[model samples]
Target: MSPRWKWKGAEAKALAEPISKTVSILQSSLTRTEASGLLSNHNVLLSVEAEQAELLDRSCFGRPVVACAEKEDKRWIQLTFEEAFFLFYNLNCIKISLHGRRLENEVELWRFVRSIKPNFATSYKAYSHLRLKNWIVRPGLQYGVDFVVYRHHPSLVHSEFAVLVKSVDGNDRLRVWSDSHCSVRLTGSVAKTLLVLYINGEEVNREDMNLPLCLEDYTVEEVTVRRWSPELNREHDLSL
Candidate 1:
């Protein structure tokens, strides 16, 4: 059997297969999530046999890594913080360890993740939201977006939309006209629509908010940002 992760409308063969095993991600371990806010399925190290390496290379489940080909080398699959938390909170498939200590529960894990990721709440909401829709959300830093959502596994099809999480509260100082101008053009060039996901809700106290499951309390709205070029939309004088 493969990893145990599943979701609504998920296909068995190509989805993120969560394994029933303890995945120890050391604090020192390098993962794709750090450098890029996006994730890939190449981090979580597993306890598979040498022969299984050949099989893992073909599936989206895992990828075999051989740094130096030492006899003591262990195989692993990598997961971003969002992916790791999803498995733990939603599916309860794998246990997480940071620097040799196991994160006992979601609360503990949340606290730990918060210490590292400042935008954990907003990004996670967007991540989980897309996930429930059966869209595969992957890293989109390359496209200058928070995420690139795929209709299916990334390898099977192109991502239809690029998402950027923003807040509806205040003037949203992070966004400006120039940013929108650049983002729309960048996404358009790649054939992906830019979606500005606006999150709104009551502001929660950080001291206590991070302690509870408050993702449901927030509301998410998606606005598609498209380029308007009059040259392409010109109305011809057919009557003349």
Candidate 2:
């Protein structure tokens, strides 16, 4: 079983245990019960007090703005919405609160997060998919993609793939030829593969949002694209 907490801060430990009544009651269409059980035997929600949130100003949750020792931290939570959900939904480490009131269960939390991010389900499906496969995922804003994945920790190895989310409803985005070429070219320049995740291409959103978290309702397919080079395509000294 996965460890309950990555860092056992006093407050985080206090926050991590205790299965909410709502969690066990939820009837999500769990497509991978075995995988889910491997991480958390019970379901999880999310939360962090402002004081505890301040602690996240470091490397794990967020980055140091100036990299100097004496600067006031003028940054937001470093973890993206997706990352937060991963900590809650996958790791079951924290319960999320808005306006200081905790969102008691996954159903309530999912609705809240979905309201803020229209593409929550699709984005999260890809994020959790990579995570379940044991890849380290981080936001790819710098690379102009949805995510960047590492085989190991960022300090141990550089990111190996840049991910782009493509939803059937198109709430996130799909690249055209020029955009696609640019994405491929950019990732290639940095020695990374460009992977596009097509979410729910043939399947439509389940009408009842509650039925979706199981991953059975969402379908994600990955496609990797690279720009072919004639000069590099030849073997040895053979001409193309």
Candidate 3:
């Protein structure tokens, strides 16, 4: 049997808007010089298709979907906005190879979002945090911290925390590596923030441990546990 694939709905939607806007901007901004640059970067010859020629002549915004065609010799080719961005970013040109021939823009933001895995991870983390009632969690660019969790009620007087997620393949081996990396990243002034190590289910330990709490690993899971501070660390009493 094949492993189950998880679906994230909210993230799939957030990615669409930005991709649509980028397509519109690129279409309007493509000048003779820019076009030449794009062609040179991708190492492709460029000619606009008749259908899209008038669309290019006029300015359009937030269309979400558009198609462009390329001309080479006697042939005319069509492309999507997703293909256009890929060409622009990777080859520095607008021409793309789709459905056998060179094609031009039909950039759907969702398509671009689906192609890149990291963006999905960030989105998943954001959604997960939001669902946990952490309203202030947003995407962070620097210091390798994926999500910042803020205190929901300011009156409760708890420190804000940062969550670092590591998707590891194995239990024992990945735990050591995950710990070292998390420690280094969460050290110094930010050390006060709780360091939670979320792992996939595979390994089990006999005893309940304390401090810089190492929670049990689970597969396809979400659990929020408070970090063990030196002052708050206590032994698990079996005397019930």
Candidate 4:
């Protein structure tokens, strides 16, 4: 006969204890009015301070307080200011790889990511340009850039560049589709192209803007977009 699996209630309780403690601490730090303001800012619709406190108390027990209260005809207490900030802080700890692929839920991650790094698309483009320059770069949410690259030489200026990264395939197609599926046309003859290059900590400019004419042109490889996975969603603590 196969052995029976046992539920680890104790372990579950132990894990929940810390979260409860944290919530209690946060509640104690604020007054009723402040707590109400916090919830209001996070779009939580609470009728009274007492209701908000009750929700916080329930959260510690790993209960779906918002959902449960709604079911009971009680308006859900929105996430308190402290709670919202802490939640976002915890979310940024999740690592995002290049090509916008997260080992976790991209949508969930994007919500937190967008909250913290609103200009994600632009930063992504700047990172791509830097990557082509052969500098090792990764997403820099803390610095508010799409990426962070290590400087190999001291002579190179340590500066951040604003980048605009767009989905070449999707945006183009979407634009045309929205415009009654009509094809877009390119205007004007090419006069001159400018090539901007970064080599050994120096920016080199050239008249002809072609990859072959650039001082150091490296082929950029595309990173495949990741799909949402149910297993990954189950692993993360997405209380919502």
For each candidate in the order shown, give its overall lDDT on alpha carbons: 0.61, 0.59, 0.36, 0.32
Q: Which candidate do you rate higher for lDDT, 2 or 3? A: 2
lDDT agreement of model 2 with the native: 0.59
Q: Per-residue alpha-carbon lDDT of model 4 for 81-147, expressed as tens digits? A: 2233333222221122223333243344334433554433233334435533534343334433233
Clashing pairs in 4: 44-78
Candidate 1 lDDT tens digits, 18-68: 322112222112221221111222233444334333333332233445563
Write down the TM-score for model 3. 0.31
Candidate ordering by lDDT (highest first): 1, 2, 3, 4
Predicted structure with the largest TM-score when compared to the true one: 1
Worst 10 residues of 2 by lDDT: 32-41
TM-score of each: 0.69, 0.64, 0.31, 0.20
In candidate 3, position 150 carries an lDDT of: 36
Where does candidate 2 stray beyond 4 Å? 1-78, 171-174, 201-206, 210-214, 235-240
Model 2: C-alpha RMSD to truth? 11.6
Off by over 4 Å in 1: 1-74, 168-174, 231-240
Q: Where in model 4 is the C-alpha error above 4 Å?
A: 1-103, 136-240
lDDT of 2 at 13: 35
Q: lDDT: which is higher, 2 or 4?
A: 2
Error of 2 at 67 (Å): 12
